[model samples]
Target: MIDDKTTPCPFLGEMVVMFCQAYPVRKPVPKHLITASNPCAGKGYKGCPFFKDIMAGLGGATGVDPTLASRDRKGVTS
Candidate 1:
């Protein structure tokens, strides 16, 4: 949560940075990154670097589908 406001673009001073890798273009909004505490939720996913990256399939370092991850966490197996 780098919401210092002094930070530059791509570093919108949010937790999104911790879950994403930088890209030339903006990133995409990751569903997994969306939480009740996220400030961007109300603002939508426009001009968001992390959101753009996720849309381009370059974001989310979790390496696992969020749905699957949740299921796994619950000990649910296919």
Candidate 2:
């Protein structure tokens, strides 16, 4: 079962450690937050700069923005 706190960033290519695919590295980089668990594995994922950049570049994927759907899933009121 999925944990409520583990929102998982879409740019997170792998689950064996917080490997992020938002960078230009040959392989996804392992990320973390010394202050807490990585945001890539939590609701704070929406705050990632890379996530925003990638989502912005995907304008043509669909007329509707994906964040709206995410918010609905998490019951976030915009």
Residues 1-78, candidate 1, lDDT per residue (tens digit)?
787576679745544332223234335576667776674655553357654555455334545453353233333333
- Among all windows of ten consecutive residues in candidate 1, which has the lowest summed lDDT? 16-25
lDDT of 2 by residue, 35-73 (tens): 357676767876888767656666635455555544443
Residue 63 in candidate 2 has what lDDT? 59
Q: All candidates' TM-scores?
A: 0.23, 0.41
TM-score of 1: 0.23
> Which lDDT value does model 1 have at 3?
75
Among these predictions, the greatest TM-score belongs to 2
Q: What does the lDDT read for residue 39 in candidate 1?
A: 48
Model 2 residue 43 CA deviation (Å) reads 1.1
Q: Rate the local accuracy (lDDT) of all candidates.
A: 0.48, 0.54
Judge candidate 2 against the unseen true structure and give its global Cα lDDT, from 0 to 1.
0.54
lDDT of 1 at 62: 48
